[model samples]
Target: MTETHEIGMVYLAASDLELADAADDVRGLPVVTQLGHRLGEVEDLIIDPVERRARLLSVVSGGILGLGVTERLVPVEAITRVDDRVHVDRPEPAGDGDGRHRGDPADLAEEGYQPELVDRPPFAEVYERYGVMPFWTAGYVVPYFLRR
Candidate 1:
């Protein structure tokens, strides 16, 4: 039996996660410059309808903060899991490619998600009204989104 989704809820699993912080050292990662740079933060992890698994919605990041904070809407299928770390499958930069990105990051359902749900800001007004962030605690997993 499937669980019913809440009126305004986006769901993801616990296993599919990679946490990076400002203090962490990005040794092998490339620099912030370059157009086709595949680095972005893990802004969101929504369920993938096709793979039925937790996926990385956002990755390292587009650019510096306070401008747009552009996020990559990667599908769950591309996420790779190993011991103590989660990895995202970013496409290699192709020479002489068009200006467009490798894939459509908008491959998520808009129904249950609002920008206020995640820490990635720009919904300051709306999130402020709530007075609480969506997932605050360490084990903030929603059971409805999990399939065992």
Candidate 2:
């Protein structure tokens, strides 16, 4: 039986292996599958206020994004275990047929980093209409938000 109610985010593992002893964790782990893989696993967790738990909303699925991969929504409860590998049961998106949920815009806007979005094209238009000012540096226009 599990003891801790509040999750201990960090854990331990034993090491020391020979050259042939191991492959890359993602490539070798059975926890990774075609429909989804651990690489696409979330690095940072997001807490949904309504749901009230830390969920695996997105994963760092090893393609190439700032946090190392894309942001997707996964359910926190779907986790069966987390150990030598991360495991999950992927979720179906909400009724709109997009991965997005129906909610207050204020909630989502509160959830993400908008300074970058403010500087871009369509995003810029949206933000400007909403009166959001994009980040600027030396008066140059960046395609996306970049830190100064």
- lDDT (Cα atoms) of all candidates against the true structure: 0.33, 0.31
Clashing pairs in 1: 39-61, 40-59, 40-60, 40-61, 41-59, 41-60, 41-61, 55-76
Worst ten in a row by lDDT for model 1: 96-105
* Model 2: CA > 4 A from native: 1-39, 48-52, 65-68, 90-148
Residues 12-109, model 1: lDDT tens digits? 43223232222121222332212334454554444333434442243334433333344433333333332223343435323311111322234233
Q: How far in Å is the alpha carbon of 45 misplaced in model 1?
A: 1.2
For candidate 2, the per-residue lDDT at 130 reads 25
lDDT of 2 by residue, 2-58 (tens): 111223111001112122212212222333332454435443333322322332233
What's each prediction's clash count? 8, 7
| Candidate 2 least-lDDT 10 residues | 8-17
Residue 29 alpha-carbon offset, candidate 2, angstroms: 12
